[model samples]
Target: MHHTRLFDSYICLDPSMWWDNQALLKETKRALETRRFHGTSLYLGIANTADEGMDVTRVLTDTTTATLHMRSALQLQRYFEHNQQNGLKYRGKYYQDDSHMSVPFIAEYEALRFLFGAERK
Candidate 1:
């Protein structure tokens, strides 16, 4: 989720701007590449949002993190399926009947449940 937003702001919106800041990009990439988690790390991405901009290939190959992406079929810009096909774990929750604004309420709840269903807390 954070990655997607950063990608959109730093890459998609202005690639030249991002390229000009090579040092920043290198630092960020290094940080992302070296991150280690003791327990489990989970990512949750939502459709009609910044989720589509995420680099799934880099994420899957660079780290052994697990991600659960959800989206609505009704949202024309949603591209979670394509990224999922490229190797990201996807939990299909096609909110075909729901509008973009309504998806977050349901999707966020589903994300929390998916992430912590096994927890005693």
Candidate 2:
């Protein structure tokens, strides 16, 4: 079961949901331009699903964010090697044997290691 499918029945029907992207982008640019660092840091570990609508290229452009691209998992493509080679603070890990729903088991572990500088066992 894909993660989104599990929540398919609970999607929001509110009209305000669509108003935020444009506003948010404008605010984000202003913040960035003003050098107002958000005071918190985040590491993104996207599954890099082949059909994902979010543009990986754009997301990875932000140097402050580190991403872990899952290469062999369902929904994602093989992106780890190229991204890693480019010195983008991204790591590639394989979960070739797991389904999308099962990826969290291994990915969560890898994410912790990536964020905390732990050695992989």
The residue pairs that clash in candidate 2, if any, are 48-76, 49-75, 49-76, 50-75
Off by over 4 Å in 1: 1-29, 49-100, 118-121
TM-scores for all predictions: 0.31, 0.33
Expressed as tens digits, the lDDT of each residue in 33-108 for candidate 1 is: 4443223333333333224444434333432222212111112113333333233333435443333476667656
Which residue pairs clash within candidate 1? none
- What lDDT tens digits, residue by residue, belong to model 2 across residues 7-91? 2121111112113433533443343334322222223333333234435454344332222222112112232222232222334
Question: For model 1, what is the C-alpha lDDT against the true structure?
Answer: 0.35
The residue ranges of model 2 lying beyond 4 angstroms of the native Cα positions read 1-80, 83-87
